[model samples]
Target: MIGNYLEFNVFFDIIGTIAFAISGAILGCKKKMDILGVIVLGLVTALGGGFVRDLVLGINPPNMFQNSTNAIISTVFSVLVFMFFYFRKNFTSRQVLIFMNEFMILSDTIGLASFTITGMTTALSLGLDKKFLLIFVGSITGVGGGMIRDVLAGTIPFIFKEQIYAGACILGSIVFLLTRNFLGDQVSMIICFFTVLIFRLLAVKKNWNLPRISD
Candidate 1:
């Protein structure tokens, strides 16, 4: 039972990484970055969460570097996305922008959920027993990729904005931690992913924001 759950988690992690890499590549293309720059952005975004997770877990070298398959997959996915966008660049800039925006939102949501769960799992393995730390690690994993992508692309990180981005990750981590014993691993993971994704979508749709004080 435990083996199956672990396999499922790894599967989802790989999918999420690839999705984020594609998203990064697409965004780079939209921003008119060169091919090398696009690939660099994609690689960083795909691996950033895992890198952070490993660092926090005290895993030397990080799984992203140790696991050759993950790196190869990320690179190939990024290249494919870059080529597709390059070929389609003749389309109107407005149309391309719209398409990229839609893709970014969907991909980012999936990546956020996957990385959040993975981060919580890493924290658990690292002997982090506190719920607060789990939530913090999950939020970091969820937003780390976007932060790296934004820095590479020379834009402000999205999580620093007024959006409910990290909030969704925190909610998901809380759900996972609260229900893991009751729901078991697989169901708990699914619940967490769906909770984050749905909340993120609703937040975006409703323009949800954290309260801020004006100077």
Candidate 2:
């Protein structure tokens, strides 16, 4: 059961990585960044979460270096996506926005859920006891890539201002922690993913936001 759960998690991680890489490439293209910049954004978005996770875990130099497959996959996928957009530069803003809205929603949801679960799993393996630490790690893993991507692209990080962005990650981590023992690990993961995704989409549809205080 554990082995199957691990395998599924790894598969979701790869898919999430590719999706985020595509998102980064799309954003780079929108900003009229050079090809090198586009590739950089893609690489950062794809690997940034895992890189941070490894660093926090003290896995010196990181698994991104140890695992050549991940690096190659991220690079190849990014380049292909950039090329696709590069050839379609004539697309209107409305068309672009439509595409971006759909793409970002899908990619961000997957990335958020996968990273949250992975972060929680890592924290548990590392013997972290605090529930809040699970939430923090999960939120960081989910948003770290977009933070890096936005910084590199000279834009505000979406999660800091966007509607209920990191909320999904927080919810996902909570679900994972709460249900890990009651359900099988794989079942728990699936439930967490769907819970986060559904909540995120609903938040968007409803334009949900936390209360703000005026300074």
On lDDT, the candidate that comes out on top is 1
Writing each residue's lDDT as its tens digit, candidate 2 over 1-215 gives 44647787787778778877877877887787888888898889878988887777677877788887766777887788778777775655688768866786677677777777777666666667588887888778888888899899998887876679888888887887788789877888888888888888888889897776668
Q: Write the residue-wise lDDT of candidate 1 on 23-72 in tens digits.
A: 78888887788888888888888889888877877889888778888778
Q: What is the lDDT, from 0 to 100, of the residue 161 in candidate 1?
A: 78
**Candidate 1 residue 124 C-alpha distance from true site, Å:** 2.8
lDDT of each: 0.84, 0.79
Which residue pairs show collisions in model 2? Answer: none
Give candidate 1 misplaced runs (Cα > 4 Å): 1-4, 126-128, 213-215
Query: Candidate 2: worst 10 consecutive residues by lDDT?
Result: 1-10
TM-score of 2: 0.90
